[model samples]
Target: MRPTVLLFDIDGTLVTTGGAGRRSMEAAFEKLHGRRDACDSFPMSGMTDRAIVRKAMHIIGVEDSAAAIDAVIDAYVAHLAEEVHKVDDQRYLVFPGMREAVKEARSRSGFAVGLGTGNVREGARVKLERVSIYDQFDFGGFGCDNEDRTELIRCGAKAGAAKLGVPVEECRVVVIGDTPKDVHAAQGVGAECIGVGTGTFSVQALLDAGATVAFPDFSHPQALEILLGGR
Candidate 1:
């Protein structure tokens, strides 16, 4: 088997933040612009953190300048750190078998596991820290890497390949995520995507979106096979 790179998405795939992300973003907008509904009109799924703030600024009739986006992101992260702890435990959840899956992948030889998420590095840290899984992924392609999903996914693949001391082209890169955007991003980089239906999208929907395979969650027996086998 060739050295493989497994990139796991944070939100919805490994864990749900119990609306901590949304609330924090909303609070940031309100604090900065006095408009909490800035992002309410659009879905934040599969969007980069900077992109999300940029879009929300546009919708709220604010100039989406780089500095403005940074301000929102900084504020959002601060709020997220606090909100993650305040949310009801029932609403915050780590999907079934995600930890086991990550652990299993880590134990395998010739495999490197990390994150490929829309969250910027700091935001990713805060969210995963709440669930006690922040240390699993040592490196990633974050929203800060690029506003475009394809570019970020490519960035992640390259980083993973670097960890294995091989060219990205020589490594089999697999992306595990919960959105059609994940499928498209993996395709963009000539990687395969294993879509999970733990998000708003369904398994059939993910398959229709061109995922190599779709599972309800990592708890599915076959999920590990395809994840490890790269077929």
Candidate 2:
């Protein structure tokens, strides 16, 4: 059956942010929390924004409450804005065959596209727009909404289902991402996950994480077809 919802991960899946996201997070901590030592070495690949922030706070012995989280996010936004201004060349690039994959998925009957990513709402928009693919996603779940990756996938699925006026349970959700976290999130919701080894993780790692299918990269048309086919 054709998937009713195609949930995509932003960084490392649709577009590559290089080290911009990590730099932004570090800048936020330094500027807002008055701690340059915070997040000196935190694993960012495939982790949610909230998870990253919470871990960074723990490392600095700071408590992460709702208010503190908001402040950090605000700081992150500010830092991202400032950094984006300084960079004359665009660093974010759309993954090869990503646009064609999105288009093909959308062309399929009963298919809809949305994002489930670790990026905050504004950050997600900024990155997607930087790559000129912001309009492809109809809706999304942001990192600010929740700390859990599974919850984010659920939120994205719900939003897509709502947009199509279908029941969430009836939606055939297919999650496309480049991390084990994404595979786990899709498994949490009993949805199909397609793992692309374009990120830090390898294809074997994704398979071990329980992805329905894994690819070295989506640059191949056959891989893209299999992924969009919900295999």
In order, what lDDT does every prediction score? 0.92, 0.82
Candidate 2 wrong stretches, greater than 4 Å:
85-91
- Winning model by TM-score: 1
Summarize candidate 2's per-residue lDDT along 146-226 as a digit string, tens digits. 789999888999998887788989878889999989999999998899888888889999999999888877876577767
Clashing pairs in 1: none
Q: Please give me the total number of clashing residue pairs in predicted model 1.
A: 0
| Per-candidate TM-score against the hidden true structure | 0.98, 0.93
Count of steric clashes across candidates, in order:
0, 0
Residue 69 in model 1: shift from native, Å? Answer: 0.4
For model 1, how does the per-residue alpha-carbon lDDT over 1-231 read when each residue is reduced to its tens digit?
989999999888999988899999999999999999999999999999998999888888998889989999999999999999998768897898899999999999999999999999999999998889989886899999999999998999999999999999999999999999999999999999999999989999999999999999999999998999844
Q: Against the correct fold, how does model 2 do in TM-score?
A: 0.93
